[model samples]
Target: MYDIVIVGAGPAGATLARLIGSKYKVLLIDKRDMENENPKKIKNKCCGGLLAPDAQKMIAQLGLGIPKDILVNPQLFAVRTLDLNNNLERLYQRFYFNMDRDKFDQWLISIIPNEVDKRLNAYFKSFTEISGGYEISYIYNGQEILAKTKIIVGADGASSKIRKLIAEDISSPEKYISIQEWYECTEYTPYFTAIFDEEISDFYSWVIPKDNYLLLGSALRPREDTWNKYNLLKAKLIKLGFTFENKFKTEGAYINRPKRGSQLYGGKDNIALVGEAAGAISPSSAEGISYALKSSLYLAQSLEEGIDGFLDRYNQRIKGIRLNLLIKNLKSPAMYNPFLRQLAMKSGLQSIR
Candidate 1:
């Protein structure tokens, strides 16, 4: 029997395995095959892959080292308001680093120990409560394997099967969907820019700089009109000097918004949910990697203290982070207004003195 069984070998599962593998027997499972090396084979993740400064700090604290080359240092920039008259105003103060998500996730998994039982191409079928822990059934290599685990962690993406097994009373929200496309560029700039419209009502587009390419994406409320809005934004971008010489197909994914009553823990017994499986992303920014790492760290610490302590710590930490982000998002529309954007930009420039 293993101490922990983690579902989904993405950031959260890999990080947690590395964190607790030395001290405990852990099993990390993913539906994707381990032999798959092609990045395009994985699900098309809709993210600009910008890692904020705080996220960097958390990585250091967790001892999850990311290579320097994979980090894209973009010249500090801000949100630009695309006004009705086509006037542009910039909001300053926020700075971030663009990243390649595939590289980031691959690097994270690389650091984990080989001793950690990694079952790629394995799908978790179901779980049953055993006497001391839980019995996990999974399909591997066209065969089924039953493993006993003391703890089961649901690190699967937003739609988590483990979550469904654990939180019987939780409900998820349907909010905005983010679509992204990557283009290979012969030449590229070093600035990360976000183009947004105040009229479209909560829709925005971003151009994130990478080493030799640009990651372009748009976010909008889910509706039949969303595609039309995306087309309009794409046209505007092309008109405003942005060009994709070598184009790639577009990819999309949905982001859950400020939902309530999602349970993070199954019960006092053994199962816990982490990462997007628990709805940890920020509603406005859709930032979840940092939270995933943070949640894993919190879960590891909690395991060390005891079950009750773990639950308490998890609740306290997540509640504070979620509530804070909600408040900021609630105020972002006003903060991104044209006048405020200009003033903020001017103030930022002045502060450099």
Candidate 2:
């Protein structure tokens, strides 16, 4: 039996394994195969791949550095905010890095200790509580496999199978249907764009610039007319004079959002949830990398102290983070109003001056 069984090899799972694998018998399972024969067959994370400064700080705190090759655009230094409702545009300078989402995930997985048992192309099917540990059932290469562990970690993404089996009191977290369009960036732009259009999304849409490509994406609240909303966003981009040099493709995925009163890091019967599985994504910005990395770190540190009452300690630690995010979430809807947007812009410009 393993000490811990992590049910996803994405950033959260990989970072958790890297932190505690040396001391524990860890098994990391994922549906993605980084070494797949066909490159196109690899997993599509369906992310804008923008790493905010806070995420970079946490990565450094963890004693890790993003390799140069993984960086698609390292000089992203500004964000262009488009208030489509008022036909107003403003520029705000912020430091962020654009990356290849898949490559960034691969880099995270690569740093994991070789001693950690990593199972790729494995589909987690179910979970059960056994005598002294938990039993996890998964399918590997068409055959079923069962593994037992003292602790189970749900580092899985938004639609987490582990969370479904483990978290009984908590309902499924709030989720958004994110759609993205990719195109060749003929002209290299050094800044990303944020589009605020309440007519399309209650949250917002975005246009991200990379060294070689441009990505336009938006998240909707799980509507049937997602495509229609995307089309409208596309028309808005065209109106804003965004030129596409060679339309590559479009993709979509589900992203979790933090909900008020949600238990971000808690578990029952030796199973703990972290990352998106625990609703760690920021409610206002939908940024997850910083929260994901930090959540996993919190869990690792707590577990190192003692597995007994670990979830309690983890929950206590994340209380401040949850509160801060909830406060921002409450104010986000106000940002969509033209008057508030203009006022905030004026206030910001005055502060800078």
The lDDT for every candidate, in the order shown, is 0.71, 0.83
- Candidate 2's C-alpha runs over 4 A off are 263-265, 346-353
Model 2 per-residue lDDT tens digits across residues 224-299: 6888988888987887798866888888889887667564646676888888888888877888899889889988
Q: How far is candidate 2 from the true structure (C-alpha RMSD, Å)?
A: 2.0
- The C-alpha stretches of model 1 lying farther than 4 A from their native spots are 34-44, 72-86, 91-94, 198-203, 259-269, 306-309, 335-353
Clashing pairs in 1: none
Using lDDT as the measure, the top candidate is 2
Candidate 2 local distance difference test against the native: 0.83
Q: lDDT, candidate 2, residue 32?
A: 88
TM-score against truth, every candidate: 0.83, 0.94
Provide the lDDT at 113 for model 2: 89
Q: lDDT tens digits, residues 1-353, model 1? A: 99889998777788889888887889999986644687667654467778776677888888656687667655444444344323644444566666677677767777888789889878999999998889999999899999998888899877778877777676664457787777887565655666757554364567776666777777777775887877777777788787866766677877655544343332335777777777776655667787788877877777776544566666666665566556756756544565655555555553322
Span of 10 residues, lowest total lDDT, candidate 1: 259-268
